[model samples]
Target chain A: MPLPAKAFQRWLHGIAPDTSMADVCRLSQVKRTTLAQQLVRGKVAEATVVSISRAFNVSPVTSLAYFEVYRDLAGPLVPPTRQELVSQIATVDLLRAVIARTAPEEGGGGAEESTARPAESWELSPVPHATSVKNWVDAIDDGELRHRVSAATGIAPQNYSAQLTANRLAPEVAIATSRAAGVGLAGGLVATGLITEAEAGWAAGARRAALDGLSDGELTALAGDRLQTLGKALRRQEHDQEQTEKIWENLG
Target chain B: MIEILQWTTLVACAAATLSRIPNLVRKKNRSLFYIFALMTVATLLSIKAPYLAIDGMLGNTNVANLLLRFIIFGAIYFLGMRIAKGFGDVHGLQFIRGRAGTVVLGLISLALLILFALMDSEGSSVGMMDVYAKDERNRLLVEYYGAAGRAYPAYVCLAILPAMLRAAGSTLPAMLRISALLLAVGGIAITLSLLFPVIPPALGYLTFIINYTAILCFVFGLMLIWLAKAMARRKVPEHIRKPAGT
Candidate 1:
């Protein structure tokens, strides 16, 4: 939902008490004219809010909660499921761990300790597509959960599949899936990289704890599966690019 | 029936042209403005009443027909160049800009002018076929001239049809995809009409339907693209449009 002008102004004042509008625009990486237009319209856009939140190093969900529209989604949440926790690991981090497992130790390797230990906080970045929507859905799916969520949300199977492939879940679909799985309602949002775990009330190091808790065999299998999917995705992208190139070559 | 179809298509073309008046006034995409304006005028001149009036002013020697031909040529040339570049089709752009394409267009235009000059020009008519039907020599020249007029557009359309069809089925925005589909179908219809002589004579009525529908579809397709772009400039995403008063 659009943030109200007054609420936005209040949030801006709180975030940067002495900062000028030009500074705000620069910090948010939003154009001055665009910000002015939104202010004049009496509602700021959601992306602008996210940009401002990122600029100030605050969780987007927490920033959004300052507006009345997102207040309910910001605060505390129930503990996340094991699947939800694992889903929070950034894709590159997961891949890095997999690669690190095989790499020769520099001096008297601590490979065993490395495999058993939790990830460092810096390695747990939450970029979009870190875990695809499909993976998150699958993580929560206890066989019948997907069918139940589909029925409850009234999202067609094909449409759901398309959304999964696109790596996006509509907010409603995300909420419904989380509800069906009986996990924290914010799990879907967190897993999808739409909101941070801090804002969702997940304890610090929870994701690392879950990753460390996994058996070496489970971790290897998961990494292998992800790598296979990544390979297939890269191939598909190559094919599409080739097709586009051919069209340009022959027709342009 | 043909007259009704022609009028309907003409009106659609005019509407498409008029829809871009705001863009023209704002000095946005002036090339597109000229292209649509030229196309609209060409469509208007295709009508009997306007053609007769304009032709009368031009000495009633069928100079208006030649003017209409040249306007259509200019419009199509600009359109082909713009669309090829817009689609980022380097090959299509190169072909149109390269010597081969330029020579083909030049030859066709020259052939059309020479054929028109050779034909009987005592009276004005909407079509060369209609006025020169009685003059055996002029009839042949008119046919060649018409064929020459159709050649360049068909060639360009053939080159762009594949890209347009692919775009129609792509993941582009809904309006753009629809526009691509309409434009592709219009291009196909136009190509078919241009090749009508090779088709069975019994399908003459089909040709008329395709011809008029193609004009309407092509113009409306361009209009939709313009409308979509204009709307996109001002549009706030659905999630961002909550009531401000609240």
Candidate 2:
């Protein structure tokens, strides 16, 4: 059987127990009357949807999915399948992960990388096993994890905790946490069955394309040891190619 | 009406000076502190109080003119340096701060002063206020000084203003965005005043007014920036305040 048509409403209530419908309207900067009417008619404006999502500390995609379910209920009233719900939620999670990685801190500083182990040394580290999001959350110190997630995603600490307890991973938060903990995104997401290998490959390619777009000056301006590692690697590759060419000439 | 405008300009200069003191005391930004200090001195020199006494001491050889011009040049140079620093151009800052750069700037100021003195006829004492009423030679000297004064700051503004505006347009803090906007307006105003001198006899009375308005705009714009920094400092918690050079 398909999930109930009221699944979106139920999810909203579960995640944001302290937040009222009026509070959501107020925080979203929309009129309470307008929102009420929209909810009644099973229709929400796009901008209003974004505001409501932000107000409840939920991802915009997830909020839109919830609203879509409501909008669809006004028609044939066929509930969403389990797989469909999972896909919608997983997309929201992934978006949140990307946002957490990219968002600048209060002073316009980039998100701080973990100082415990350098990113370049990850190859030498032991490979981590894929864990379910709920199990991962349970294993870690909840307070520190919440703070990191909040810093990354701009989601409230309470909402972050509630989402984790409910066995949902805001993709950005999950990806960022996994990255910091030295578990790769693909490993975590694949283990959870949240993303297929094809989707993971596409994501990796997109990231590479984005990095390739940066100008030489911008690449140089990037702070930390990442630049040093990249410079060393480039030089080593050049040196190896030169040695190989000399050997080929000697053979000829 | 002229007297009122003169007094208003003086008031603005005084306000700009007072507004800068807190930032100077905090020592938050060295370039900004120097910009305000030089501006205050420039305003005082403009009114012919200290310069009149100095000129008399020097046998009215117009040495005070050289001194005043040097201070104005210093103000413009510092303003350029501050903008360069804001744009995160470390090399630009190094160029301005280097010994070689300082020597070049000093030489340029000396050359300009000598050229102005040579251009002016013997014993001519045409105040900046009376530039329009003066003869062609004195008017040319004033025009040269105006052009030279505006050139450095204008170049700096042209190079960095777009970058600053882009930064401001992004998701930066509100105070930073406002400060960038104020600085742009001030830079544009200074450029305009230089480009359009009060040359026509009918508008001769406006020479001092226009100059002072430009000065006020530049100083007030910097003052707003100082205010923004002060606000940011207050927002930072006391416990996190680190010692200097840490």
Candidate 3:
């Protein structure tokens, strides 16, 4: 049997059995009537949810996610707009680009590859194959692909297929799918005109030389471990650059 | 000893003038260049030989005295405005931005010039060395000239002192901070000289010493500020470092 739609309410009741709804309102600093209406509708504001979570001594993100799951179970959520969907996909594409740029070569022989070929020969291919988001998603045939993508992206498995079908996959979902399927979805998105040329250019430029010797499977496997390291390094570089500029401005 | 001190001051003024030439050639910070140029001319006039030479050229009517008084006072006023503007640029203070403050200063300078001219007479000499030895009536006029002349430059210096101190305390580079400190010291020195009431027999020599020391400090401070900026531009950011073992 499927789990009850009121899982969040049930959890709330279990944790705060003796605490009245008025007590929750008082603790959260939300109005009694508003809390009651939100509880009934299975929808809570993030601030109110965080406050309630604090009152119950629960993790705020976990509590918020529970509420989101409960709200979806209670009613079908409205789909995101097309523009939002595209933006989400672009963000995923950007993440993937970062991954591809930092990923090591397939044979672990990056130095060797450079030595074997002239530096200019490693420039990105001018006419790489183009594929759309729909075409890329359709190519994957595994029954558990939705689950894998959901696990990676944190989107519900049930919604993955629908989102993929409607071209509404969030960036995280796209990144997860890219990891699972062993392909760069961002490149495909760029090719299909979903991601603009300007948006994709930086990623392409950064990764082109690094990725020259790597095959499809190697890039996908590399994405899982390199994400945090590259993200941190990029942020550190940006911070250092900012500090240098500030020092120069002060000297002036 | 006083003549040697005067010559040292003249040398310092000449050095300041030479230092500003590169800045002028680069077309950078023209206001600062003009300040140095004015200071040089003022310093030249303050020396006995140049003052007497110019006095002789003007048929000993003391017009050079009037002209030198105006130039020195005007230079100090302009220096104050420039410092105020520099402080404004660094700290975003609105009161120091425009020409209105400088115009007000100019008017005050003009008034001082007129006062000095009205005090000048057949017996009343203008330069510090000759002014003290005149008759009782002439001495009163010379005292007026002396007080006004010292007080105006002192006022300009004291007015800009707080801003220089603030700049010294701010996040400006070490050289600029040092520059500001030097300027503040110069301002304080000039102000102290003005505040002293007793006219020592060595008053002329003392004034020349104080004025030159202040100008040298200010000039050195400005040079450090420029040097700091140049060094900062030449520094490379750490992120642009080459790959390890490259």
- Residue by residue across A140-233, what tens digits does model 1's lDDT show? 7889886887899788877887788777886546767887888877777765666667766788878777776776688778877776776676
Candidate 3: misplaced stretches above 4 Å?
A1-252, B89-107, B120-128, B202-205, B237-246
| Model 2 chain B poorest ten-residue lDDT run | B237-246
DockQ of each candidate relative to the true complex: 0.05, 0.00, 0.02
TM-score computed on alpha carbons, candidate 1: 0.58
Tens-digit lDDT string for candidate 3 (B132-203): 465665567666666666766776776678778876875554676788898888888788777445747666
Estimate, for each residue in A8-118, the C-alpha lDDT of model 2 and write its tens digit: 356557667788887777787989888677666654444465465666666544444454332321222222222222222222222333333444432323333322224
DockQ rank order: 1, 3, 2
Chain A TM per prediction: 0.68, 0.26, 0.27
Write model 1 residue lDDT over B39-112, tens digit each, in one string.
Answer: 87888888889998999999988899988888988987787777777666677777777787899889999998
How much is the lDDT of residue B25 in candidate 3? 88
On TM-score, the candidate that comes out on top is: 1
TM-scores for chain B, in order? 0.89, 0.70, 0.80
Q: Best by lDDT, which number?
A: 1
- Which runs of model 1 end up more than 4 angstroms from their true locations? A1-133, A136-163, A167-210, A213-252, B199-202, B236-246
Q: Worst lDDT window (10 residues) for model 2 chain A?
A: A121-130
> How do the residues B1-246 of candidate 2 rate in per-residue lDDT, one tens digit apiece?
755665666677677766656656876454565676777777766665555666677666665666776787778777766665555545556656667457657666766766666654334253543542468876777667656655554554555556456645643445555555656666565665555554676876665665676676666655655565456456753332111111
- Error of model 2, residue A123, in angstroms: 33
